[model samples]
Target: MVKNSGEGISKSVLYLMSAGAGLVVANNYYNQPLLNLIATDFGVSESAVSNLPLLTQLGYAFGLLFIIPLGDKYPRKKMVMIDFVFIIASLLIMALAPNLLVLIISGFFVGFSCVVPQVFVPMAAQLAKPEKRGRAIGVVMSGLLIGILGSRFISGFIGEYFGWRSMYFIAAGIMLIFWVLLKLKLPELQPDFKGSYKALMQSLWGYFKSEPSVRLAAVRGGLGFAGFSAFWTTLVFLMEDNFNYGSGVAGTFGVLGIGGALAASYVGKLSDKMNKNKLITIATLVMLVAWCVFEFSGHSIIGLVIGVILVDMALQSLHISNQNIIFSKNPDARNRINTIYMVGYFIGGAIGTTTGAYAWQIFHWQGVASLGVFYTILILIFHLVFKKSLA
Candidate 1:
């Protein structure tokens, strides 16, 4: 049962909160479809335009490190509202950017501010009972997955039809509305960590050092995310160059991943009854196989569709599994544990994105596929070493 409030979650409220959180998180990803447009507008090389994704992912890592821990020390609702405002500002900046550097900078702030979903997920898990926590998290995560997958198409359409800059204007308006809903509907909670900022930062490090499961999950998710990102970061280029498709066609690939995102809702239900370590191992193996499929199918549309579905499913499943493990560790420290795991995950993503971009520039789709496989191998190796230990 849902625990903290002694009442079941109102379905409407739950869905709204989840959707709001998902929209906030989507800010981190909308640039993928816009990269080519931005390159053309700024007269920058593809690799230079690649900085948008690379730096945005990096900004997420930075926020996960510095901002997420604040969840434990402040009122979450206020923090979320504040974050929404920052997102609006950042989106506005991106919409009006005069140069590549300005757009990159705005993308960074947008990413940094988008970590609100991390806070929201943990808060949802915390409010629910241990038994319901997985499902609650699953519900919230479903929204996140939808936003991630949907933004590709929706944002791509907005960018293609109106211009890439117009997409940000729409996002900014949505964020403003979301802020009002958050302010009106969310409950207030007291701080869990009462220490000063410096002390809290130190304690965060302590938690990472002391928690075996957190470290294991972080490494596991980090590797998995790296592999997941490698394929996606370079996918647009492959679709455009090899298939002679535009961003619109590239965005349609998002549909392939929706099944996986929907499956994430069930993953938590599975986690409630299954051996999480085994599940994670299975997910990692699937990820490796998915990358192999992607590498082999880079030239075939049907092959690409199959590979995308498998890869997205594997990635989302592993993501849910990792969260199930980490959040179960300490309810009070959920924010910090998430901060650590996400920091690792996004850093891995940033590295993967950067490497994929340059590799795409030099070695083309083959290079991108190779990087995905390499990261998948790293994830598999990490699982092999720690699966027993995690168990």
Candidate 2:
């Protein structure tokens, strides 16, 4: 039987959360492969279309900062269901958008609603038995990882065949189906904090001010991610420009990059068993190598494949590892802590997307690869200074 608050979650509900989180989060990524199509339809330059992803990520950052804390003050199930309503509307707007302005505005809402998956993550944590919490979170994470890895590939093929709008249409339909499923399957969860919105916001700032570890980890992970985001933002453009390949070919790289994402989960486990400083240090050094490969050899497919794997593995390592550090600091404050860290994270993504597009417009692959190396170098500098916390 399905359990209520703090009791064990049913296997079916757990699977639903996993699938729901995956599909919902995938909404954030579907645009990457479709950027080429978006550019073509709008008759805009690569730099212009880049704003779509950039704005979406910025929107996600804003939502993380602002909306996440509400879960602490209110029932989660109702909040998620409400978020889905907005997501559906946004996806529909995107599917039928008449102008770039409309698409960009709606894209932001999509990212904002994309925060729903994050809500599911914490919900899974609360519902599973203490002994099984890790496994539960891992199951959900696996779903998330698969959704991320598969979205590009799925969207690429769909966008190539049925028109880019169809992808959004299909995504909207899936969200609608899940919306109904969740309403039926999910039990209402109680609020963890009884604080007002003002106090919640204040506490987040307090953590940022007081936690040296949060600061270090957020900075290290954010800037490091900016570089990798640049690569992803520019990858489709690269495929089209250099190899005369389409979105489908460009997206297969997502599949190839799965190794890196998997490597991140491994590093997350190691955070408990290994020294944080040593673990991150090695990951940083590995990131440098990935960027160097991109700079020198990214023109070739084999080189591109290798660089993608290495960079993803390295970037995701920083994410999972840094996240572990923050979560360890104060259990009661995890929601707020996650809010601050993710805000910085997605903000970095927005900047990287902008940088990638602008770089591609001018110097092409060399510029993209060079800036990536530069970002990795900056991460290394920051890590050395912040490595104390990792110890």
On TM-score, the leading prediction is 1
lDDT per residue (tens digit) for residues 1-391 in model 2: 2223256767887778878878988898899998989989999877788889888888888889888878777888899899999999999999999988899898998998788866776676667765455445555665676677678888888989899999999999999999999899877777767778999888888889998888888788788878977888898988888889998887788888767655543565566567767778888898999888888765699888888888877776676667666766565566677788878878888888888888888899999999988888888898898676546
lDDT of 1 by residue, 1-391 (tens): 1225346466676677689767988888888977888888889888888889888989989988899999888888888877777889999999999999999998999888889889878877787667877777888888888788788887777777889988888899989988888888887667778889999889888998888888877877787777667777777888788888777777778877888888876988898889888888798788778778877786899888888888888888888888988888777778899999999989888888888888888888878778888888887787788777756
In model 2, where do residues sit more than 4 Å from their true spots?
1-15, 124-138, 263-265, 389-391
Highest lDDT: give the candidate number. Answer: 1
lDDT of 1 at 108: 92
- The per-model lDDT (C-alpha) reads 0.82, 0.80
lDDT computed for candidate 1: 0.82
Query: TM-score for each prediction?
Result: 0.96, 0.92
The count of residue-pair clashes in candidate 1 stands at: 0
